[model samples]
Target chain A: MRAEEPRLDAAGALAFKDHLREAVRDAPPRVVLDLGAVDFLDSSGLGAVVAARKFVANGALELAALTPAVARVFRLTRMDSVFTIYPDVPQAIAG
Target chain B: MPRERVRFRADLHAVRDALIQLERGAVLGPLTGESRSVILLVLAEVMNNIAEHAYRGEGGEGSVCLWRKDGAVMARIVDRGLPAPAIPAATDTPNPADLPEGGFGMPLIRVLVRELAQSRRCGCNVMQLCVDDDNAA
Candidate 1:
């Protein structure tokens, strides 16, 4: 799933999560979220991404193509260790 | 010293606009790209908290003022909203195995900033954050 929004901050975190939940209602066991276009992410946005994983049911939720700003948030929170991050969507799907 | 200030309503969308205005203005323009990203991250956490917690009910207005202090970027965020809850001690990120979602905000603010201070002035909540490029990730 691609995040069309340039920013995934507090302004749209909830909506993003809700949208993800709706999109994944009948998803496969593995889901990969494409974050290449999201330039900014705060803790609220980070939480929304983490929360998106929970929406996947028994399957796993992965991430791809973190921008510099978004990468910094994950690194600072050490959330980089938590989520499976990929250089791009294809790489994420390949793994 | 060059200074810039961005003001916005308490809503979350306005918070994003304020960050963009501050990022594009002259104050952060002189900094390195990495330094600016660090500043933006710290300020985004701070402003979003105010929008979500301090002004949750009735909503209000807020402003972020930026200036240089001894080679560090200083940001003063002032909002006419409710007083903030007590700050938690600066702690390491929780065990990721827990799949934590909500507790990363304060810890990110505590880790990325060189200095953090908050107070209630008159009827507003005032937060000060210092972003030192040398120390920030």
Candidate 2:
């Protein structure tokens, strides 16, 4: 259960995408993305989450725990229905 | 009925503060949770676009001018950075699945705001966003 909130920027989006790919490389994975401290999220930021979900699905892993703003983005884009979203880290891990 | 202009850095935190102030000052009538959320989302998207693509993370300042006229809340953002690309014509419905996070900023702005305009003026990019007060109904 590894988590990180790398500094978000235009260029940081690429790094974040790579991080997601790396995180899901191992099998039987459990990952939590903490977005509570993230006050800002751009399209690139949102895309990284989507890409991560795709990676997790490939390995039969679960991805959850989206903060309010991030959850709102997923909802607006209808990705919320696609991803299993939880309010906090514990709930995400437990579920 | 005079317009008010605020200049601040193009950072995300600063833009969030500006959106909060905008809601406090401009939003009249009942402040429903949904309304507040939508306004914040719209403003944040626009500001992020200016900070990321327009300013290219160079830490420049941009101006947001707000004015109420004809029962509408109007905001104009002027930035001395890259010019905005021409917006394609609006389709009937948005395709969320195909939406790329990187390119959705301007499109999201257009969807959330009642009226949106973009142009390049004197080597600066000027974007106008408006929300109709009636939409709250």
Please give each candidate's TM-score: 0.92, 0.65
Q: For candidate 1, lDDT tens digit of each residue in B17-135? A: 88888888888988887888888888887888888889883578999999999989999999988889756656777777788888887788788887878889999898888898676
Candidate 2 residues B48-77, lDDT tens each?
777876887777888888777676667788
> What does the lDDT read for residue B17 in candidate 2?
65
C-alpha lDDT of candidate 1 relative to the true structure: 0.86
TM-score of 1: 0.92
Could you give the C-alpha RMSD of every candidate to the true structure, in order shown? 1.7, 4.9
Report the error of model 2 at residue A50, Å.
2.5
Chain A TM-score of each model, in the order shown? 0.95, 0.73
In candidate 1, stretches whose alpha carbon ends up further than 4 angstroms from where it belongs are B86-89
Each model's fnat?
Answer: 0.84, 0.29
